[model samples]
Structure formats: C-alpha cells, structure tokens
Target: MEITEVSITPLEESRLKAYVNITFDEVFVIHGLRVIQGNHGMFVSMPARRLPDGSYKDIAHPITNAFRLKIQQVVLDAYKEIISENTLEKTEDQKQENVAVQ
Candidate 1:
C-alpha cells in the first residue's frame, strides 16, 4: 500500500480543494474534498447543501475548536492510510488487467 499521488483542484472563489487516493489490498478509492474556513479561526466546515433561492448554509455541525483540530488530524491520518491501501489495490488490478489482455 502506498500513495502514488496527492492532488488538489481549486474552484474560483472557494477554499483550496483536497484530493486523496487510497488503496486497500487490491482496491483503490479516489476522493475529492473541500474544506472551507469558518467565522472562528478554529472552526472549519464542509457545506452540504445550498438553497435553491440562492443562500449558503451548512447542514451539519461545524468542526470547531478542539473538535476541528481533532478532525483535521484524523483526516490527515486517514488520507495517509487510505493512500497506501488504495495504491496496492490499484496496482494489482492494473497488473491483472494487463495480464488478461496479453
């Protein structure tokens, strides 16, 4: 298991994006994430929904203070773990696919 690449894509006027590729055994998962800054320095959240009328609102309880910090730590750790697992799986799959072709 390993991390082949970590990439981020930015949207105009939005916070920086987060991209992670994770592998487990012989399977890999790619995830796209966005973390937005909140009013409090210690708080950050991901917006879940936008009103049709055109208003911004967060649907879930924000990650704030110690909670936000903890969440950040967890996310980082998860990203690392997922990458290794996903890489291994993805590589194996590609190998098999190539073998079958030949």
Candidate 2:
C-alpha cells in the first residue's frame, strides 16, 4: 500500500513533538502516531495502548522491518518539513519586528 497523505499537528513544551495521521491509498487512515524526541534524536512511535499491567502495546504497526523503516522515514521527514517551515516563519517575523524597531 502506498502512503497517499500525511497530516501532522506540531506540539511544544515536551518531548512529544507532534501527532501524525497517515493515509494509505487515500482510503485507509491510521491515527495517533507520534514524533518523539529521544536520546537518539527523533523517531516515530506507533499507536499504542497502555495495558492493565502498566506496559504499552502497539495497536497498529508494520509487520516487517522494511515497512517499519518506511513508516519511520515518512513520518520523520514530514515532521522535519513542518519544523523547517515554522522556523522560517519565526525568522521572518523577527525580521519584521527588527525593521519596525529601526
């Protein structure tokens, strides 16, 4: 299945960077995926549920390592694009403020 779309909601104030939803073939969609900041930098976390035993179990995940890597790459790349755009916007705003002050 081809990934048809990816939607992201960026977050602040925590290691949880964003929430993501990905659509496959423009029909099947998966929600609650996450972009997380970890010791290794950033990675994608599949949707999971907390079990009664206090451990987490993935609710939806790719079965093969290759597919898992594909999902990770797609999610992380989208997250990075969002961050880059936000950074550019903030830089533009700063420049406008500086010009107003001058």
Writing each residue's lDDT as its tens digit, candidate 2 over 4-58 gives 9999999994799999999999999999999999998999999999999999999
Please list the residue runs of candidate 2 whose C-alpha ends up more than 4 Å from where it truly belongs after superposition. Answer: none
Q: State in Å the error of residue 77, model 2.
A: 0.7
Best by lDDT: 2
Clashes of each: 11, 0
Candidate 2: worst-modelled 10 consecutive residues by lDDT: 11-20
Instruction: Score residue 26 of candidate 2 by CA lDDT.
Output: 94
Cα miss at 60, model 1 (Å)?
Answer: 1.8
Over the stretch 1-102, how does candidate 1's per-residue lDDT look in tens digits?
A: 433443433333434424433323345443533534445531224334779989867544324566546545555555446556777998999999999999
What's the lDDT of the predicted structure labeled candidate 2?
0.95
